[model samples]
Target: MSGSSARFSGSTHLLCCLGAVSSTIVIAMPAGALARQAASPPTLNDPSFDAALPPLDSAAPQPAAPPVPVAPRAPAPDPELIQPLEPIGSADTTPPAPTAEQAGTGDATLRIRYETTVTGLAGFKTDAIEGDLGRQFRALSALIKDGNKAANAAQVKARADEDVQLAQRIMKAAGYYDGIASSTIDLVPGQPGVVRVTLSATPGPRYVLNTITVTGAPPEPTKIARDSLGLKAGQPVDAALIEGSEANVSLQLPQFGYPFAKLGDRDIALDDTVHNADYVLPIDAGAKSRFRNIQTTGDPVFTVSHLNVFPRYKPGDVYDSRLVEDIRQALVATSLFSTVSVEPVKTGVINPDGTEAVDLLVRQTKGPWHSLAATAGYSTGQGATATGSYTWRNLFSPEGALILTAVAGTQEQGGSVTFRRSDAGQRDRTFQTVLAIDNNRYAAYKADTADLSVSLSRTSTPIWQKRWTWSLGAEIVGTNEAGAALTLGGAQPRITYLVGAIPLLLGYDRSDSLLNPTKGFRITAKLSPETSLKGGKVSPYARTLLLATGYYPISPSLVLAARGQVGSIFGTSVDDLAPSRRLYSGGGGSVRGYGYQQLGPKDANNNPIGGRDQTEFAIEARYRFGNYGIVPFIDGGRVGESSTPGLSGMRYGAGIGGRFYTNFGPLRVDVATPIARKPGESVIALYIGIGQAF
Candidate 1:
C-alpha cells in the first residue's frame, strides 16, 4: 500500500507539469493558426511537390554502355617444353576445349588438331603397316592432313571410321586376311584442343600358300609356268607377291615357246582355320609356236636378209623371248633406231611337232644417221689441239659410214677421209679404210707424212664391250723426216723414207666399262712389222707393245686403277729408222710433267732425239662424290736408247685431278709436277681433256 501511494503521488506531480506546459502552448500560438493550416493543404498532383522527390519507378530498365572485350590468353609455352600427354586410352580421357596455344593463333589455326598413333603392331610388320597407314591417312584423312577443308569434330569421327576400313585392306595386302583393324578418336589430357587418333590392329596368323595350282595348261607346261611364278607352298600369301608372280608366269611362258601366252583373273581360297590360302593361277597358254619367217616393216635401217644376222636363233627354232631380246639388243647396239620392237605374230601355220609357226614383226623407227662432232684437248708440252669430224652414218645403209675428219693443233695438223663398214660380214666386226696426210713439228722430229691404211677390227664401243677383240691392218707411208747428224759436228739432214707395215692387235677385256672401268682388268698386245727404204737401202724392223690395266674398287665411290705399257723395236738400226717411227714417252698420256718425246736421249744442243723403246706406268685413286670425282695419280715412264725397254732413267710425276661428270662422260683437268725436276722439263704441267686419263 505504501509503494502504490508513492508511485501515484510521483505520477500526479508529472501530470501537473505537463498540464501547465499544454496551457502555455495554447496561449503562445497566434490566434486561429490551426484554422489557417486546415484551410490551405498540399495536393498529390502538385508539380512543385513532385519535383522535389525521386520517382518511385527508379529501379526500372535503362540504356546500357558498350562492353569492353577481354584479350585472348597469351600463347601457353614452347611446345618442346611441354611434355606429351599420356595416351587418352589409358587414364584420364576427358577432352578439354582447345586453348589458343594448342589450336594455333591467327590464320594458321587448324579447324581440328590431332596426332596419329598406331598401336598393337609387332616385328617387321610394324614398320610396314605403320608406313602404309601413314601414307593412306595422310592422303585421305580429314583430320591429320586436313583433307576436309572445313574440318570439325564430326569430320574427325567420320575419318576415323573410314580409316578402319583402309587399315584392314592394308593388313590383307600384307598377308593378314583375318586381321581386325579398329580406330578410336581420343582426347589427350593436358594438351587442350588436341585429339589422338589411335589405330589398333590384331593381325591373325599371316596367311600362307597351302597349295599352288596352274589351270588351263598341260602338266609339263603347267609345271614350267608354276615354277616360273616362284611361289612356294610355305611362302606368305602377299598380294603384291601374288600379282608380281602372276605377271612373271605370263612373261616366262613366252620364253618357253608359248608365243601367245597371257594370264587370267586369279582365284584364291582362304582357309581361316589354318590361315592358309589356296591360290590358282589361270594362264591362257595360247599356241606353242616356233619362230618362222621374220617380217620387216617401218623404215628399214637394214635389209631383211641383213637383219637376220642379228638374231641368235634361226628360223624353225623354238620361240624363245630371250633370243628375241638378243636380236633387239643387237639392233640397238648399232644405234640406228630410236624405237625398236620385236613381237611374235601367229601365222596360222602348224608345225609337225604340234606347235604353230609364228612370224616376228620387226618394227623400227630410224634415228639420226648423221652427226658432226668436235673434241678439244690440251697438254703442257703438246700444246692445244682441236679435232672435228663429219660422219654420214648408214651412208650405204646397213651401217656403212663415211667420215671426214680434220685435226688442227699447235704442233700438228692433219686431215683424213674414212670409209667404215660396221657389222661387216659378221656381228661386231668392222672394216675401215683411211687415207690421210699429216705434218708434225716437235722437239724430237719434224715430219710430213702421207698414209693409206686399211683395217679389219672388232673393237669395244661405249655401248658394247667385247671380251675378245682383234685387229689386222696394213699401212703404207711416205715420210720425210729430219734427224740429228750421224756425227756430232755434222749437219742435220732430212731423209726421205718409204715404209710399208702390217699390224696385228689382240685384246681381252673383262672390265665393266670401256671408257670408265671400275673393276676387272684388260690386256692388249700389238705387233707391227715394217719394211723401210732409206737412202736406197731397205731395212726390216718389228715393233711390239704390250699394255695391261687393272681396276679395284675399295668402296662404291672409290676405285684404284693402274696401267702399264712396254714397247720395243728390233731388226733396225736407230739411224736407219725414221724419227717419227721411233718409240717415245713423256707428256700427258705418259710422264705428265715432261715435254712430249723428251724423256729419251738428247742431241748436243739438248734437243730430244726420241727413243727406240719405251716403258710407262700409271696408277690412280679415283674417288667420286655424286656428280663429281677426284683423282690423285702418279705416272712413271722412260724412253730407252736400246731396242728393249729398261727400267732405268724413269721420270715420275705426281698429280691431282678433278672430274666433272656428265651424262656423256667425265671432263678432266689435271695439274702435275715432276718428282725430280729436270733441266728442261716444266715444273708444273696442266692437262685438260675428256674421259679418264689412262
Candidate 2:
C-alpha cells in the first residue's frame, strides 16, 4: 500500500471509533487530589494542546463526512487532552515527568481561576457556612479551590440536580425551611473555559421558636434557670442557640449548690407549616448540697493556721463552686505551690445534715524551697555586671519570706535585704520592709546611699479578669555625691541629701500574660512625700510618677506594644534630691538608641544630671515567627531641670530589636542608633536581657 493510503486508513479508523463513542473512559487521577476540575465546553480550541498532537496534513485526500456521526451541540475538549501521555511505570529511573513545580517553566497542569459567588446569602456573614454550601453543591464542587484545572462540562452538568438539593438543605439549616433556590451554569461567551454558576434564591419567612420547655427543675428557684437560658419563645429558631439551653441549665445549677448536676435528654422538633420549632430540655439536678467542714490533704508549705484562714465559706453555707475556683486561683497567685486543687470529696459519704465536705489538695514546690541564683549581663552603655540573690521562702512558718539580693555592675552596684509578710488573716494585704545600701555611678555623679523603708500592699480583683492594687509606705534615705554638678540654685562640687518620706501607689493590670502579653493594658501611679531626716541639702518634697503600657495583637503572630511614663518631684532642686530619687531617662528600660541617662538634661561639665521632671513615650511593632520575633521601635523623651515639664531637651531614638522566646521569658537584644545625638554622645548602643524591654 502507498504511504498516503496507510495514513488515510489510520485516520479513518480513529474517526470511526470517535463517531461510535457512547461509554466514557474514566482516567484515574492521583488519589491525593480528590476534587475534580470543572471546565466549560470548548467553543474555541486550545492552541497549547495542539502542539502536543501529531501533525495532520491539509493536503491529504479527504475522508468523507457521512461516515463520522456528530452531536448537535459543541462538545467540550477532554480534560486528558493536555496531559503528557508518557506512561508512568516503576522501571523509569528518571523522576515521573516533572510536575509543574519541578519544571518551573509553567504552573500545575490545566489551571484555571474560578470562584463560585453565592448571591442569595445576604445576612449570612460566616465564611465557613458559605464554604460548606459551595463544597456540597456539585457545579461549584467541581471548581477546585486550589485554582487548578477544571473538570469536563459533562460531569458538571450531571450533578445539577444534586446542587439544587444542596441549596435546599442549606436554607433549612438556616431556619428558612420554605426557601427555594434555582441555579444555572452559563459560559462567559468570549472566554474559552470560564463559566458562571448563578444561584437565585428566595429565602422563605424565618421560623420562630414556638416553645422552650424544661422537663424537671427544683435545683434553683426555676426562674433563675429560665432567665439565664439564651433561647426564648419569640426569638427566631436557631439550632445552635436552642441546643445551648441544656448547657445553661448545667451552668446555673452549679451556682445554686448543685455541683454535680447535669442536663439530660433534649428534643427539638421543627414544624414546616407554621415555621416554628419546639425545643425541650430535661435536667437532672442531684440532691441539694451544703458546705460541711473543710480538710487539707498532701504536704503543704504554709502552717495549718495560715491555711485555715483561706477558706471563705462556713460549714453551714450553701456550696458555691465559683468560690472554690476563686480560692484555688488565690492560692496559685502566691507563687509558692506547684499544684492546687479544691473539690468535693466525691465519696458517697454525707453528713447528718446531708451536706458534702470538701478538700483542698496542694502540692508544695519541691524543697529546699529556697532559690539561689547568680546572674551576669552587659550592655554597651553599662559595660559588664555580675549579681547574685538568695531567697528563703515560707520563712517564719510560710506566712513570710526573707530575700537578700546584691548587684554589682559597671555603672551601678547595690545590695538590699527585705522581709515580706503575706496576709496573716487572709485579708489579701501584704507588708514588706527593706534595708539597703548602694554605691551607684551614673553619667551624672557617683554616690553612696543608705536606705530603709516599710510598705503595705492591698490587692483586689473587682472584675475577675483584672487586678487592682493600692499601697502605702514610708522611707528614710541618706546620700552623698562627690564632684556632682551644682543644682539649678544649690552647691557646686559636692552634695549630701537626707530625707524621710511616705509613699502611696495604685495599680491596675488586665494583661492576659505576664512575660509576653498580646492583649490588654496596665497602668500604675505613685506619689511619695519626703522630708529632711538630717537637714543638709535635702528639703521637704513630694514626688509623683505614672506609667502605662498597652499591647494589641494585629494578627496571631504580630503585636503592637506601647508605653508612656511621666514623673515629677516638687519642692526640691535637682541637686538637692538624691540621684536615685530623681527622674532620668535612656538605657534599655527607658528610651533605646541612647546611652544610659543620655537623653536627659546634661550638667555644666557634660555629665548626665538627674532631672526633677521627666517624660517618655515608646512604640514597637513586633512580628513573631514561632519562638523568634523582630521588633522595630521608636522612642522619644524629655528631661527638665525644673518641676515644670516642657518639650525642651527632647531626644529621639529609633532601632530594630529581636526576641527569642523561651518557656521562662523572652531573651531580648536591641541594636539602636541615636536620631538626635550631639557630637560628644555615642552614636550606637547594644543591650541584652531576658523578657521584653518594658
Question: Deviation in angstroms for 184 in model 2?
Answer: 33
What is the model-wide C-alpha lDDT for candidate 2?
0.70
* TM value for model 2: 0.61
- How high is each candidate's TM-score? 0.75, 0.61
Candidate 2's displacement at residue 395, Å, is 2.3
Residue 473 of model 2: what lDDT?
91
Clashes of each: 1, 5
Query: Model 2 residue 162 lDDT?
Result: 47
What lDDT tens digits, residue by residue, belong to model 2 across residues 1-694?
A: 1122111111011111112225689998776757988998768588988777766774567777686676699878888997777766745685467566536736434433334556565664222334433343433433333243444455444444345555665555555556676667787688866676666666667667778776677735355556767676867654445446556667777777777776665665666556666766666666667765556666667655676666777766777778777777777766577676666655455767765644444444434648898877667677678889898867776658889999889878999999988775655778889999988776666788899999888755322333788899998887876644555544446567777889999998888866777899999999988876334343788899999999999999999999999888899676567666778788888888877876676666666777888899999998999889999999988888888777776788899999999986788899888885778877788888877877
Can you give the lDDT of residue 433 in candidate 1? 98
Which residue pairs in candidate 2 have backbone atoms (N, alpha carbon, C) closer than 3 angstroms, thus clashing? 37-150, 37-151, 38-150, 38-151, 39-151
User: What do the candidate models score in CA lDDT, each in turn?
Assistant: 0.81, 0.70
